[model samples]
Target: MRASLIALVLALSAVPAHALPPPCSGGQVYEDRNGNATRDAGEPGLPGIKVSNGIDIAVTDAQGEYGLDYVDGRTLFIIKPAGYDLAVRPDGLPARWRNLQYHAGPALKHGGIPQRQPDCTHFGLRPQAAAATKGELDVLLFADSQTSSVKDVDYYWRDIVQPLVGKHGAVLGLTLGDVTNDDLSLYPEILRTTMSLQAPWLFIPGNHDLDFDAAGDEDSLRTFRHHLGPDTFAWEEEAATFIGLDDVIYQPGQTPSYFGGLREDQFAFLQAYLPTVRKDRLLVIGVHIPVYEPGARGFRPADRERLFAMLEDFPHVLLLSGHTHTQRHWYHDASTGWHGLQPLHEYNVGAACGAYWSGVKDAEGIPDTTMADGTPNGYARLRVRAGGAYALSWHPARGTDDSGIGLHVPRVLRKGAYPAWGVFANVYMGDAETRVEYRIDGGEWKPMKRVEQPDPRLLLENMRDDTADALRGYDRSPEAEASPHLWRGALPTDLPEGEHAVEVRAFDRWRGERSARTSYRLQVGEP
Candidate 1:
């Protein structure tokens, strides 16, 4: 009788608790052989694909059946196994997740997710005809397309997106966050603009993308999720797995509504997800805020430490973020709780809408929204290869020259004067260890000293803004700030009277040599 009772108890427990608001659920990940997005008869299930409840993960069984426990107002999304892709939804995003919660909460300022449910529990994936099986793929990286107004959106389109409509050979594209500058209404147009690029574009939420009316972090991105798929999601490529996480924790009544950190749910997701990541392939994580806090804990230390611990096992990992309106590369070591064999690299990607689109206009009517470090508002490309190797390169939205580096040479220098004035090369993607050299008048290439000084190019613009009788453009360029990727080489004022050609070359570790040229004229005397 006891054995029978125990068996009955087991069977009872096996049945999902319908009493819970969110009942336990089961679904199958299947190959859509007919491409109908429906599980027709005779369709085969794909095994071992991971499904998640935004916190916990469950792998499909041999027959591709998976189950998850009840979680109130939770959405279930699949981990998008390599070589297979989720079908695009009507909204033009990958349909990897299904929202379990059918009703909307209190009305929100940004119009939180609607009341209707769109997707069913079952996920359908199609095998790629031309998948990147060789473990080599290029990803386009964009951040802070923080369009505030329609004009700004047009600017983003013309400057950032229009040029690359069909120009790229990228397999995927990822925007770090801040899709809009607090205006949630523009989400549709933004998605449409991005999808035109013809790649599986992914996005995460930024602080600016928050629904401030929401009570806490959990509800902060409701509108965002409704439009941009899951704020935290994982995509599998042949060479790596790209994880997009919403790390902005919202504090309801705080001075700053959100801060950079991971919540328990996000931590839970990471803990459950990281173990499944392949150690041999590269792991690219995209978040809005940078991991390192330049100020008084811009990012929570405890959270970073915990995340570092979780990621230490991965031999190769790359963190990409874009909150800061500038570009920089950070290497985390023992000081940052990263004890990995090699230092961890975090590329704090520059803003796509550089400096909040607050700069003078260029010739094309696009704002020359150069970053504080003088990096022209642009996007970056990440080239990932097999065996955990990757290269990064930045592309200026409008480039007058092919060289990635920008040069600032004095128009005229007095003859026989001290060569105090030097040519400043703002290597937009340069690091402190980058080898930068400059040659004058086709002379021998001389090493340039790396300096943490403002780029002269922007300094000149600052002077222009400061001295202008009236507002120059829609807005003035940002004040010059110290740049970490700048190099300086003193030009020879003694060079006779003719204009001397000045060429600056930066030996990039990844994309190799990039050189820019300018000229300085020698005059009789200084004004």
Candidate 2:
């Protein structure tokens, strides 16, 4: 990821020697029209590009000159404007910001943060490729890479990242949060591994990615800022505007604690920044904590309502979050303070760590890290088109195609069984608008009820661990929880003694279809 000597020097020298206007303490935002990643003589400054210090928002002047006073060691990043793209590292990580650390606090055990110079920092942006700005975008979404050790890091790359190296059409990658498991020091290695995907990786800060030694919530992200850019910022692509916020608030003490809620500065930042976004563009918000409360200790209710009120003017919005380690979908309607025509969709995505990389080891020496909800440990793909329309699909880490469907049924049953049995389909992305059905022996399709219940496959897996003779695998899978995407239909028990075919099909609201098959053999006599 090294540039030529001359280009590197030119890029470095672009920052002004002296500080600019009072608010604009940083350097200039010049146009790298030729896309060589260097500031040339003729490339003029681009105006009206929004930049932020995670609290105050500033826009570039006609000369592309902008700045902000040093503000509590926060990352200073530009909101990538329409028609322009930031220079990227060879591996496709965006090189759009300068990490400004005025104070070095406690010595970092892991990552290193660069200290700011006496003057402000400078940023350069290049013109976007025509295809990128043509109103279509695909983004790769990962939640909870959460590597805790060197071995976990290896597992993440070999099992999770390697399979998806170049498989999708994603131009960029966004990891919702929990990039590491309480080990701030692993940021460098994790960042290195993630950059291998050859796409610009944008990260939000999770509760685990905190500095336990920090005195308060404000200073908790110091180490994260040292490795990645700001914990909160915004960037625009095509007809979509993406904003990532750090919602984890740390409280320092003997037993460190944190909660889900946006800070005062973050709210101020959003209040100032969101107005500049075009109303028609798709507004995509990424947060570490789901806006909707998942449990007693979930996101703060008042904060979520306030955020909804702020978004009322915009008709197109989707929120993405990760923390539960389970996959589920939540809709915020009038009861949730969202008065939009449709409920605000919040996708609490599954973790890339997949139950913290637990369960039995597979043949490939990788953990069978399926989520507690029976959803596979994997990432998500979001396809954003013009006019604020989008589609999402979950991609499993291993096995199966892009069907995003899991099936649970009995292998055999009695011809005239006394007890009733049913087939369950755990469609990972199914929503209220989804149509799910099942058919037996090529008979007519019968509708399956959308029921919020524990996935039977995960329940059985958990049962194996609970009723084991002795210690089983490395660790037991997570306890099964009620899942929103599960569908069920009763199976016929009086069928003749024969092997019968069972098929399940689902039509998702996002114009996607999935089908899976399994067999049930019925015997004439009882065992």
Candidate 3:
């Protein structure tokens, strides 16, 4: 994994500088025809390129010159236009944005996005092949990798990232938020680890990824901008436009310091920017917190309504959020201000940290890290087709691909003991619509009842942790929760005193059929 990651960095066409950008008073999206970072005389400005102040968007005129009215406390960025690639800095952060420092913001504890306040904001865009911009997108999504410690970071690499190194051919990638638990200083290592992917990536801010010392919400992400590019920005490909926003609102003295909501600046940007986005394309909005749902606390209702109103015009939009370790899919209806022709699909992705990286270690010295909801500590792959079509699949971090289902069965049962034992299937991505069935010894396939209960697999691990003479690992697995994706079937214990095969099959709406196998032994007592 280390070697491959190193090779990936060396393979990139160019790398960005480690430091953040200064104020871009004005700039042009000129073609870097000469290959120099600067605009030589022959290099012409590219017209129709879009730029923004995190509020209003401006398009480059025929001469490629563009400007926008300044909005205080927002970064300045150029939307990566089609047929052009962003000229990135050496640090691998997207070079499309210029840091706009207020200097008036409270003295942020984490040194809010450095207040260098330079004059020039001119940026160069490299010419890209037309073929590269017109194809489908296989994206890598790590909605949450909230590594709290050095050990956690190491575990992130081994448990979640290492296995999928070169196998996942994701052309684009982004981290939803909670990039780190609280150690903002770990940003550098996080960047290096992601650099192994060798893909242009985006990052948004989360509650945990906050500067607790900052006095106000506006300055909470000072540390984040100093490292990753913009907390709110957009990147467009042929099939879709990917927009990531810092949706967490911090309240200093509130019971919950932060809430799931958008800022006024974000609304301004979306209102201006959405018009330019082609209605035919897919719209993917990534944020740290799940968009406010009925009865969901902290997420402001008004903000969610306004957001839904803004998105009401688009038909092919998908909402991606992270924060909860559990995974779920919600179809937004009129009840939540979504009056679109079809219900809005919001996929609350599973966390890569998998319940804060808790649980016992596996043979590879990595934590089991299964989420309380039974989703494994892994990442997601989003495949978007040419005509605004997309499908999703969850890849577990541990290895053996057993149909995306984890089965728990007692190793031994009393022979013919009232036929009371049963099998539990943790279908990681299963939802209410999923159909699961189980069969024994190639007998008739019996329907498995959908059940909401703690995954017995994790329950056994919890028991092991509680009964261990000494410590099992750094910590025990999290207390199991009623998993939305779990299914149960009563196993017949009326078989002969021998091993019996149990096979469980699940029908995934998108990925089709998948199956897993386990066996149980019926033993008789000695007389």
Candidate 4:
């Protein structure tokens, strides 16, 4: 495995950086007319060449210079038209994606002031551990390290993941799924880069990482299994029994779609296997798509039921998964009077490819898609204790200047039934006595009413869904599951609206007084 990874990077070293063609204006197209990126003598720009900014698309000018207003630090790249090459930086950043400080792009700043790079890193993992030890370990989860070309792999390292070398305390690493985009051949380079983190790494199957040329799902993961050991297996560490499942269900001609189930024999194997394992030990279920996600693109209800039935009786279970390119936390409580098992502690770790690698880049050149609960491209470091209790910490791959201080925004606001501007804020900190406040448009801060005697477990669990399963994509209504501990109040009606700010600050378990502020830009009606 190590040798393959080394070979992959060595191969990528051969791709050379090309100069960019001169910038073109709207209504024209530019090409490597001289077979070079630079616009040379007699190289005429082509009109009608399309340039895009994710949502908006425009054409280039006859002079080959195109202009469209853009967020400077945000990721900007041509869609890479067929038969044309994009100019790449020395480190391999696509020519259009320049001005990045580090690979993850640039940081966000407002009004000539650097804004809060949310500490998306560092959340509390379960199976509480007071200290780090050999037996107690945390797994670094990565999803879809897919690169289209060898040079693209260099971009991932130079721009995205190369910063994790000699990271302080992570024990093992696991790539959740999609190790490659479509080139199963590129797995070596991806693995080699990750292995540079100096930890034992494991790989899982994503749809793209599968062998489409194979006849069926069973054979699809054959190459993957050979590269990363058994497709379905378990490892027993001191804290928990980590079970890896080959849940990549493939359909013929569908390419990368989930439409199958665990083989009958694997189901039987797990049934027999679970009996041999200690029931008291915590079971960390690692899979790709979550069993219960808020989108239609997740698991089927029946599939979840089957998996739940398998471990329904087991206590101290935490399901760890990442497929949805978003961050969410859900917990189950038997005492909460909720129906069904509630799939306790359903955490959807945002992808390393945050928002499918979308969003604006930062000064460091990485996208902010991996923001806290909607932050930047990052990875979670879980610390599992001796008793199976753990805490989670997020590390922004591109944000921090190696400080490892990620954003900690326990408060998120949602507009309620008042004016279009009326808002309610949900605060999620570990402290029970922490005071919370909100201010709009630099107005006076107002104290929020707090309800005492709330269940911490239930409080944390309820935050995942504040609406019905239909609306919030959960099994219950948000009102029913709403925790009174999370402050909810109306916005002042007298205040005029334009661009307002909502900030929530509280002392958490770690950071004494952490806050998350969001800008709300509203337009008022004509008087």
lDDT ranking, high to low? 1, 2, 3, 4
User: Where does model 1 exceed 4 Å of error?
Assistant: 1-24, 117-120
Candidate 1 colliding pairs: none
Against the true structure, candidate 2 reaches a TM-score of 0.91
- For all predicted structures, in order, the TM-scores are 0.93, 0.91, 0.91, 0.55
Q: Candidate 2 lDDT, tens digit per residue, 1-527?
A: 35688787887688664433224367778887776667799988888888888889888899988867776467778888877778875545687776665545555455446554545656678877788888988999999999989888988998778887777668878999889999977887888898888887899989888877776887788788767778888988887999999988787773437778888988999889987888777899999888886454578888888998899889999999999888878889998778888889999888999899888787878888788788889888898989899988888885456677898888888889864788999998887778999999999999999888899998888888899997566778888888888999888988788898989999977746678888888888746
Could you tally the backbone clashes for each prediction?
0, 3, 9, 63
Distance from true location, Cα of 326 in model 2, Å: 1.3
| lDDT of every predicted structure (CA atoms) | 0.86, 0.83, 0.82, 0.51
Tens digits of per-residue lDDT for model 1 on 151-178?
A: 8888888888988888888988999999
Which of candidates 1 and 2 reaches a greater TM-score?
1
Task: Tell me the RMSD of model 3 versus the true structure.
Answer: 9.8
Candidate 3: tens digits of C-alpha lDDT, residues 326-439: 888888898877899999998888998887888878787888888988778788889888777898888877565737899999999888687677999988878888899999
Candidate 4 lDDT score at position 505: 59
Ranking the candidates on TM-score from highest down gives 1, 2, 3, 4
The candidate that achieves the highest TM-score relative to the unseen native structure: 1
Report the alpha-carbon TM-score of model 4 versus the true structure.
0.55
